[model samples]
Target chain A: MLEIKNLHVKLEDEDKQILKGVDLTVPAGEVHAIMGPNGSGKSTLSYVLSGRDGYAVTAGEAALDGQSLLEMEPEQRAAAGLFLAFQYPVEIPGVGNMTFLRTAVNAQRKARGEEELSAAEFLKLIRQKAATLKIDSEMLKRAVNVGFSGGEKKRNEILQMAMLEPSMCILDETDSGLDVDAMRLVADGVNALRRPDRSFLVITHYQRLLDHIRPDVVHIMADGRIVRSGGPELALEVEQNGYGDLLAEVG
Target chain B: MADTAVLVAQVPTVEGKVRPGQAALAAHLDALDLPRGGFSRAARQDAAQRLEAMGLPGARDEYWRYTDPAPFNAARPEPLEFAADDATLFTAIDRLHLVFVDGRFDAAASDPLTAEGVEIESLAAADAGDDHWASGLYGRLEAAGQVPVKRPFAALNTLAAADGLLIRVTGQVARPVHITYRRSALDADVHLHHVVKLEEGAELTLLESGVLGARSNVVIEADLARGARLHHLSAKRAKDPKLGLGHIFARVGAEALFKSFTLSVNGAMMRNEAVIDIAGDDAVAHIAAAVLGDGNIGRFHHDDTVFVIHGAERCESRQVFKKVLKNGAEGIFQGKILVKPGAQKTDGYQISQGLLLDEGSQFLAKPELEIYADDVKCSHGSTTGALDETALFYLRSRGVPRERAIVLLVLSFLADALDEIEDTRLREDILGRLEDWLTERAGNPGKA
Candidate 1:
């Protein structure tokens, strides 16, 4: 349901290219994993797809459900069923989590000409979703991610994805700082949210996360380009042999 | 007349007779048929004399350097005349009320509080007693000795003040007193001299809400006694297309606690000045203020000044000021904390922060700390910045529109100061008004 063809992006007001001719596609009912070393443009790809400012798309197009995602604003893209779980979720000091989530959900609903949910209805829906994710009700009353722990912040990202229920999800480094237990919980939350019509592109540095959320396809990214594509066995190979061998093979 | 004469005698002669402009102001004061020896008469005269000697505050004055009062000179204000029908402005708040129209007390509208040992009388009636604190404390904490007066509007308030409120809590009264100042017509000026004396171990809460017309000026002076605690909240709402000016002076005694909260929104031209003196040792003072201005509307200006005297050791003082300027509006803050030589172990902290929503919006912050004591912990900081782009993006990506996200950010920026207020009703009331102001701006762009 999501496609990025020959994508080339550079930092605004600078000549340094961050994403060079990157091609990726995730069709309906399939999960893809993009594993890469440091500075391999994984986070840049997510930011560019999510329409963050300061990242200029010099070439190529990113489409979601056959609609041009690059032309939409950040809010519009989210409404169009595109979700990016940020590596570093921002702390919105005064905006409570419930208020922020409700605003987001209702904005997307209104954009699609659907009736808005009342406060009671929203509370009921969010409670059910949060229960499956193991998020406490008290955390919903606080300012969004103001003082959340690393595991809690990542779990919050999954909670948001479950609430938004996007058709296309991009998990950026979801397992980077998580402990074994947190990683397991987060992967479980993601697995519960998966559906036949939804697709996910899980980006990470290690193969430990691959053991929990088994991907149908795995791709190796380096120097702003995807150089290798294979089955999930490639992830196991990379864990044993490391990226040093893959770098030489790609060269 | 005797009250005026006593005021003139107490007036320092360092600068001799009042200047021409001050003479005009004094003439305006002479026009008011105020009762003799009222709360503010002598203080008004003394302040007028000081303003005359100091001359009008100009850009050269360090405090008045950033904000120029020249725009207020377009319209000349006449002596305030009491209006019988000006009581409509008090409808928004429901409390035991005391109404002051055109700087004179209105007994018909005020509900007398007659708790045992607690006296809530008019300044005119209170002055008849031997223990009147008005004459003893008015204008005692003004910074005219150092900073001097350069603003013409403040000079006018000094010259025009008349009747006020005197609240005396004897043997520890528990209930709160709400003082409401309502401005009716344009070009109208009112001055209030409020004296709150808490006997040893007495506690009181005073909420001051000022509602002004297009062109209005108000000045208030207050005092607290030993071992007594007082919490004061002042909210100013001015929507007139003309000028609006406000000034406040207060003093606290030894071992006493004083807290103040100020909120100002929608004024063609507005200024709220607070000068506080911690006269007694072991006394504590806390001051917090929040101001929001729309750059597209009439110019909105705020000048807040604080003075702390460490008369006794181990005194504590804290000040926090936050301002939000949207559109092309301007926000200004000036705060100073002083620790005396013998006042060792004094703890003082001051912080001023401003958020500019648009490029045309402007904010100027000046925070200063002056210490003479060697064993003191004092620090001051000032910051002016725009909304965080990353925070904004995070909210927008979650489906919140840009405008709603901005409002949330602005409210978060001010929550720190608002949380410091102790009165739940007053805090909620201020928050409601802030939401109303934000809603109005959000609904109608360029119509501040």
Candidate 2:
């Protein structure tokens, strides 16, 4: 469902390269986890896939379901079924969360030649999806992510994912600021959406999140490259021994 | 004596007569036949003298530094014709609808001037009767507000304005007074002066809408007595490129409440100035304006000058102004909060913000806070910025198109000022207009 080949990205204003020739692929119906230490270009890879500006892709390609995402705008990529759950959800004042969600849902549907959802229909569907994430009605009525707690913001992102039903979902540090209970709730939301046609690329520094949403394959990323690929056991190995031995072995 | 008269002019003496750009003003004034035998003959004479002394604001004036007064100085503006298709807002509500065509009161189109506890009469029809309630308030507030700052346009309106509404509210009125202006002639130049007086403990709401024609001047003087409440809302549509100028001079009495909000859209040039004086203790005054200008057709400039005075102890004042400019549009905001001596415990808040859609657009804001009272609480803020990039990216990443995202952000920027409206239905009505403007600008009617 998602493919990346020799992806090299650099800051637009500076010569510093963040992602250096990284190659990875997650086939349909599979969950992949990319584990790395600090400065391993984990977040950069997610932003590059989502088509954020101010980043120059110096080399390689990224495709979603055989469609090149590098050429598409951020919103076009979203309509093509690529969702990036940001590590820091932006607080947009004066825009209600419910309205934002409805706009996003209808926009994607309209782009795909689907009929727009009525307000009543949207409200029902969002309520049902929000129930699973435990997001109350008050939170839905407030401005988008304004004054929201870290855990609430993550849950809201998951709610969006459920509503849009994107084929490829990239969870970037979703568990970074969440507590134990919030993490469990988020894991439950993601576990419910797992299906045969959908895939996920879970990027995180800790293996704790992997315990909830177990990955079919684990890739150890270092120096902007996928150095090793293995099963779920690889995450446990790294968690126990840390990345010091792994970096030495790669060197 | 000639030298003394020149000294009285308070400028570089060229002659006994303080004439700078009075040629154009004199031509315009010569054409306007002054109404004879009114209650404010002396006040009108004084204002006319002041207008002569301080000619129309020039490029060198301190307050008119950012705004060029050349457009408003034309001898006679060539009317720019426009067909307005949008229906007048707030028509469904039950209220006294007074219509003005080409700045003249259309008695046939207006409702009968009769209501319980309310007296409505046109200044043109009201004779110079000493018993008339409006005679006292005709030009009282306008004259009082000219101190420390000279508003020549308002002074000119005080003298030449005859076709305007005079409203007196003695008790609580259930219906609002809706004043609508319609332009029938393309070359019409409208001048209006309105007076509103609320008796002690009275309450009333005033609604104003319509697009004044080429080279128009309007001044509304409101006097609120003790414990009275006045709510004023104006939605000025700019369908054509014309020079629309307006001034609001109000004196709020002790324990009275005065709230006013103006919504102005695209125009070639527009200026709305508000001067509010909180005279009574424990009174509250709020003045806000939201402006949206489009420079796609031609040069668009809009200015909002607001002055809020906290003159009594424990009085509160708030001034909120927001502007959205796109495609080389220019927006100017000059706001000041003044707290007089002995006005302790005065709470004043002022905020002016602008959202620039592109690089060509400009926003100029001058915010000032003058406080002589040591125990007062006053704060002011001014900001000019583009739409938040991070917020834009977030919205786009969620599948909202770029154009729709920008519209949402722009609306968000103006939300605080819009929220100042006291009525829900009126707020929604104005919100709809804003969304329509955004949709038209986006050129995506179906999507936006």
Candidate 3:
């Protein structure tokens, strides 16, 4: 269960406000999609929820399973079962993908006061997860996101989501630069990890990705606020009409 | 010009002005008795006079701008009381060990000096001989390295080194030769010089570890014949407050390969200078160093000065230096590539990067390219900055703690320099050690 109550946020270095009194809720086992035009504060909502720096939360509260998230660090948020799949996966040279995954997995486990996974166990689990996503062993051995194509970066993010197994997954514009086949592959990867206790906040501009993943609900956001909420058909309506009619109707 | 001065035993005055610090050099030399009447007797005599005329470095010198040379030129080594059990870095491999304690060879602690396809003789033994095979080679390359720059410490070592190894490899040596330097007493100042020669079609890997002493002036002069290959790797992580000066001079022949990499973790002051000359076509030479320093522990300052001369056609050279400094530590790099007239088809590259964790830490670099040839490719770059904030956020968002993420980023930054190591096992070993160092200090920014 993820809940946002009248969330307000502004840029740390500027006077611009990115999120304004947005309210939303996602029950467990539900997939919700946010469809909006450009400059709709879609990414800011995700970043603020994930505890990323450079955002000052002026008001409201965000919580995962009744635990406040704004007070925790990014790593603490990750350990608390909140995962944000960055739209732009950072290219970190010198650190291999496999190493990053293992370290992340072990770190979360340790934070939760669980026994850390051994090297062999972590390697086996990552190999199994990567196999389903068609990630080759060579890709896992290279530096994280270095020399990776657009689709590869997205797939790598899915691999990370799978490894983390978070309770609330936020895909921030994950389908922007992805092609059809690549989007389907990524959707399948995300769909495979869906469980009864897991919830997803898939943020995207198009409805094709929702067609594959099959979101249960959709929300229309504009000017840093969500104006309307509806079922899956709402995504198709916005996709066909291009958010013009929706924004005007709400106005 | 300095080499010629050694041959003539006279100061090669330039522009009718003598080198600075000669008076200071004379006063500094008055405190010690130089090694005399050895197999390298004439060479030592000439070097002493040459060093007198050239003088030791000072704080105001151009090349010594980033690093103060007063420590190296001090009449005696400052007292460094810190000590630990010195260990060899290559214990995972089957290699011959030559241990030196306080500038003297410890025969009981060292392996036998006999190896197949290789001949090793201590400087003590070589000095006893009136005529020796190393007579022409010893101190020759060091003298030659002094032409475009002044390396007074190396000259001082050539004149007064008490004991070192004289190695000659005629065939491929399967095992590496590891030289471990250790000091068992305080206030130990050592002047040790080593001479290494590789004949045609020969190969050898040399390894050195540990700090020489509280104040150590060390030199390794290498002469590589045609088709020869030499791999030199050193680790200086005494974790103590001390000063060390090291020089590596090599003369490479046609189709030869010379690669040197040094990993310096923590030291009060360490200066490494490597000068290489490509005497024949189709040779390749690479010099790189990965340094980490924390001034909070004591005082940390590391400098790497390199000069690569391409005198032949189709020769290649590379210089990679990466440093991570925190708590007011400083790192310096002065690297240059000289493409002589008609030295066409030269490929040279140089890059230096520093990741400073705090406002007090700094990295200074001087990368130079002096090329007279038209058909050549030379690139040089230097960068210094803090850890990438985005990368840090990415790692932290993935559940890695803030401290551990910093260490991981540092390992990533040094990956390019570590890649210069061709041996996988050795590289991994060094990587593991680099991690330990970072996790110990760099991981905890304010912790000493």
Candidate 4:
């Protein structure tokens, strides 16, 4: 469902290159976890796929469902079924979470040439999805992520993911600021949406998050490239001994 | 009191001290004629003397440096085509309607000047006889407001007003008095003065809207007694580019509450000044403004100048001003909060912000605070910036279009300024008008 070939990305303002040359692919109905240490370009990969600014994709290509992602705008990428869960969700003051979600839902539907959901339908849908994530109505009515706790922010991101229901989702360090309970809740929310036609690329720094989600494939990424690919046990191995030993052995 | 008589003498004298601004002001004032205008003679003459002493604003003056006073000082304004539309605001709510056309009171178009618990009369029709209530308030607050700053335009307006409204509230008025202005003549220059007086334990709500004319100079003076409450809401809508200069002079007594807000949309040049003085203990005053200017449409330049003074203990004042400018439009805000001696526990907060939609737009703000009392909390902040790029990208990444995201963000940025409105319905009405302005120019993000 997602493909990247020799993807090279660099900061637009500096001479530093982040993603030198990376190759990866996730088939349909599969859940893949990318465990990387600091400066390994895991977050950059997600941002590049999501069409965020401040980065120049110097070489190679990334695609979602056979559609090129680099050429599309961020909103276009979303309509093309590409979702990126931010490491730190932005705090947008004065914009209610419910309004933001509704706007996004209708926008995607309009882009796909589908009928827009009515107000009542949207309220019902969001209420059901939000209840599962423990996001009450008061939280939904407040400003988007403003004054929200770290756990609440992550859960809000998960709620957005559920609302959008994209074909391919990238969770970029979603567990960084979450506690064990919050991680479990986020995992449960993600697990509930695991469908046969959908795919997930979970980017994390530790094996704790993968313990709950139970990825089908685990990839150890170091220095802008994936060094090893194996079953979920690869994460357990990294947790036992850090990436230093694995990188030294590979070297 | 700067020797208003000696400054402009009918006959020249070798010992006369000629102020620099008065010569050009006298020359400008020469082309116009004065009249009685059906107002209290003493009040009109007092205002006229004040204007003569201070003179009109000049570009080189310190206070007028940011905003050009040429449009306001011109003897004759360039005529504009009158905008003939029936979309006068405040029609959805029940209100006592009073209409004015080109600064002239339109009796045929206005509702009867009779409401329970309130006394409303046309200033031009009311006889300025002895013991008249208006005689005490015609320009009293205005004269007091001019001590620290010279509002020559307001002084000129008081003397040249063609018509006005005199409203006296003794009890809680059940309905708001809505004053709407309409311009029929293209070259019409309108001058209007309104006064509202609230007695002790009284309450009132005033709603003002519409276009005055090609050029308009207006002033409204409000006096609130102890335990009185006043809510003043006004929205200026001018389809045709015009010149508008307005001022609100208020005297808030002890334990009184005064709140005023204005929403300015389009104009070639517009300036609104508010001067509020709280003399009684435990009084509360808040003045806010939201301006949207698009120079590409008609050379937009909007200015809001506010002065709030606290003279009694435990008084609180707040000033919130926000402006959104695009297409080379310029927005200016000059706000000051002054706490006098013995005014302990004075809580003052002021925030002035500008959101420029593009590089061509500009926002200039000067926020000032002066404190004399030892125990007080006074804080002021000013900011000018483009929309939050990260927030915009976040919204876009969630599948919302870039333009739609921008509109939403703009509305959110303006929501803070609108929060000062206590009435939910009036706030929503103003918010809806602001949203329409943003949506009309949604595609013009002025960025890549």
**Best-performing candidate as measured by DockQ:** 3
| Candidate 2, CAPRI quality class derived from DockQ | high
lDDT of 3 by residue, A1-251 (tens): 99999999999999999899999999999999998989999999998998888999999999999999999999999999999999999999889999999999999999999999999999899899999999999999999999999999999999999999999999998997889999999999999999999999999988888999899999999999999999999998987888888899999
What local lDDT score does residue B197 receive in model 1, on the 0 to 100 scale? 65
Instruction: Assess the local accuracy of residue A242 in candidate 2 as a C-alpha lDDT between 0 and 100.
Output: 99
Better by lDDT, candidate 3 or 1:
3
Model 1 misplaced stretches (Cα beyond 4 Å): B1-41, B71-94, B99-118, B121-133, B138-158, B171-176, B179-181
* Ten contiguous residues with the weakest lDDT in model 2 chain B: B439-448
Model 3: per-residue Cα lDDT over B1-448, one tens digit each: 8898687777554656654587668767886667784789988988888887778887788989988887777788877777584374688888999999998998899999988889999998779988888999888999898898888888888888988999999999998999988888788888888999999989999999877888888899999999999999998786676888889999999999999999998756989999999989999999999998888777899999999999999999999999999889999999999999999999999999999989999999999999999999999999999988888999999999999999899998998999999888888878887787778774455554
Q: What local lDDT score does residue B168 receive in model 2, on the 0 to 100 scale? A: 89
Candidate 2 per-residue lDDT, tens place, B32-134, comes to: 7787646667667878888887788777889888888877776677767766735468887888888888898899999998888789888777745544677
How many Å off is the CA of B314 in candidate 1? 2.4
Backbone clashes in model 3:
0
> What tens-digit string does per-residue lDDT give for candidate 4 at B1-448?
5576666665576467766567666765675555564437788889888888788887788888789898778777788876564455788989999999888788999999888879998777773444468988888888888879888888887777767898999999988999998887887788888999999989999999888888988899999999999999998866557898899999999999999999888655898899999999999999988887877768889988999998999998999898988889899999999899999999999999999988999999888888899999999999999989888888999999998898889878877878889999988788877777677667554321
Pairs that clash in candidate 4:
B254-B280
User: Candidate 3 DockQ category?
Assistant: high
Best by TM-score: 3
lDDT scores in order: 0.75, 0.88, 0.90, 0.88
Q: Which portions of model 3 show Cα errors greater than 4 Å? A: B1-20, B85-88, B442-448
TM-score per prediction, in order, is 0.87, 0.95, 0.95, 0.94
Model 1 residue A123 lDDT score: 97
What's model 3's lDDT at B230? 96
Clashes of each: 7, 1, 0, 1
